[model samples]
Target: MPTPVIDIDSLTKVYPRQIGQPARRSLDDLRLRIGENEIFGFLGQNGAGKTTTIKILCSLLRPTKGAASVCGHDVRTRAARSCIGYLPENPYFYEYLTPRETIDFYGRLQGLDKATRAREWDALSERLDLRGIGAQRIRGFSKGMRQRLGFAVALVGDPPVLILDEPMSGLDPLGRRMIRELILSLRAAGKTIFFSSHVLGDVEQICDRVGILVEGRLRTQGRIDELLNRRNEQVELVVSGLSAETADALARDALHARRSEAGLHLTTADAAAANAMARAALSEGGQIVEFTPIRESLEAYFVKEQAS
Candidate 1:
């Protein structure tokens, strides 16, 4: 396997308490590896220590035990920090700076040459749709605009990896779509993306793999389809024109059966049972309207693991 762009092993973090309160472990023996050029989604409920893990990886917070490395360099060292572009959940900027100036400032901090800075700025402005308001001051920018700028600043150095915290938070549908496209585009350019999000739909849509964290523990991590398919398979059959007797018989044997305005909905545990149900419906002079396998969704899997 190719070397992991982000590697974490036996990582733990504890927040010191004042007075009588006990120290809280924000992360506990967490282990995760993100491969090169892959889009990996980090998922968890509120206060599940998602932010703590990201902070540790970004060198914003030190782990009490264990180690984390980015691009083969220890996160605690300047070399590893230079390999990542980090966009915090709530990105702050100098109110007086324009989007242009903001990118320039970050580029300077990264010690990028003026020529390199200008080239990256132009490319980012066009890619992130920042051309219209690139000169607008930060104070008056809308949330979505600020988000676009945040992305531009993070990309100024063109780091090989991106670590974004809640990149889609507080955005309208359009804004969310824009960010989603940007993430996909980055992956296409062979940059590793590690991000956290509560929006399961976006995760399902864009992520190559996912890791679920619950209460500071790594609950599960794998390809989304593999995790979802580990559960038992089910099939749904929709039939119409079934006689009352046939409908009653189906309800007695099916996992679930219900009547709706469109048709009778029947759920079975396997394809064989579903085929039998369809044949039975047809023998009773019913018309088959739809037959669909009910695959487990990412949200269902996440919720089940979190609850466990």
Candidate 2:
């Protein structure tokens, strides 16, 4: 088996108890792995320890127990830090610097040659749609614009792995789409991405695998389809021309039923029942308008997990 780019094992973190306060455990015995070149999404409610886990992975906070590694190097070492690019939950920058200057500063810190920094800046600026505002002072940039710049800084080093916290927090719909495309593009270039977000839809759209953290504990983790498919599938049938009595009869085997101007909508968990409902509707001089089978959505599954 190919080695994982990120390996986290039995990780835990606890904040020290203060006067008149309890010692808060920010992470439990959590364990996870992200394979090379994969896009992994971390999800959770606010203060669910998602940020704490990310901070540990970035070496900003040390785990009270267990270990984490990036590119086979311990997260506490400089070697591991060099192999990963990190964007904190709220990235700050010099207010007087322009995008070009900002990226250049990061490039210099990474020990990139001037020529290499120039080339990377041009390429990243174009890829991130920052050409127009590349020379504008950071103080003048909007929140979304700043978020884009943060991505550029994180990517400037061309590291094999990226750790981003709430990368889409300040983005609009269009900005979100742009970030999605950029992330996919990075994956295509063989970069591993680990990011946290509250935008479940975006995570559902792109992540190859996802892990949900709840109250400092890992509630669940797995492939998106596998997790969602665990729930029973449901089918919906829409039929027209059915009398109220016929509709009621059809709904007998259905999980739910509703009336619409065009038809009676019936939903059943059993595919056989859905088919039977359609046949009964046709027999009653009704016209079948639509039949749809829908698996549980990620949001639905996430909400259920959160409740549990």
Measure candidate 1: CA RMSD: 1.9
- C-alpha TM-scores of all predictions: 0.93, 0.93
At residue 126, candidate 1 shows an lDDT of: 92
lDDT agreement of model 2 with the native: 0.89
**Which residue runs of candidate 2 sit more than 4 Å off their true CA positions?**
243-246, 283-285
Residue 231 error, candidate 2, Å: 7.4
When summed lDDT is taken over every stretch of 10 residues in candidate 2, the lowest stretch is: 228-237
Which stretches in model 1 have alpha-carbon errors above 4 Å?
A: 19-21
Question: Residue-wise lDDT of candidate 1 within 1-308, one digit each (tens)?
Answer: 48899999999999999799988988999999999999999999998889999999999999999999999999999999899999889688999998888888899899999998888789999988888888888898888888988899888788999999999999899999999999999999989999999989999999999999998999999999888984568999999998898899998899998889889999999888999999999999999999999988899988899878
Per-candidate RMSD vs. true structure? 1.9, 1.9
Top-lDDT candidate index = 1
Superposed by TM-score, candidate 2 places the C-alpha of residue 60 at a distance from the truth, in angstroms, of 0.8
Error (Å) of candidate 2 at residue 206 is 1.2
For model 2, how does the per-residue alpha-carbon lDDT over 1-308 read when each residue is reduced to its tens digit? 27889999999999999999999999999999999999999999999999999889889899999999999999999899889888876688999999999999999989899999999899989887789998889997787888888888998879999998998886789988988888898899999999999888999999999999999899999899899884467888899988878888887768898888868889988677888888888999999899988777788889999999
* lDDT (C-alpha, whole model) for all candidates: 0.92, 0.89
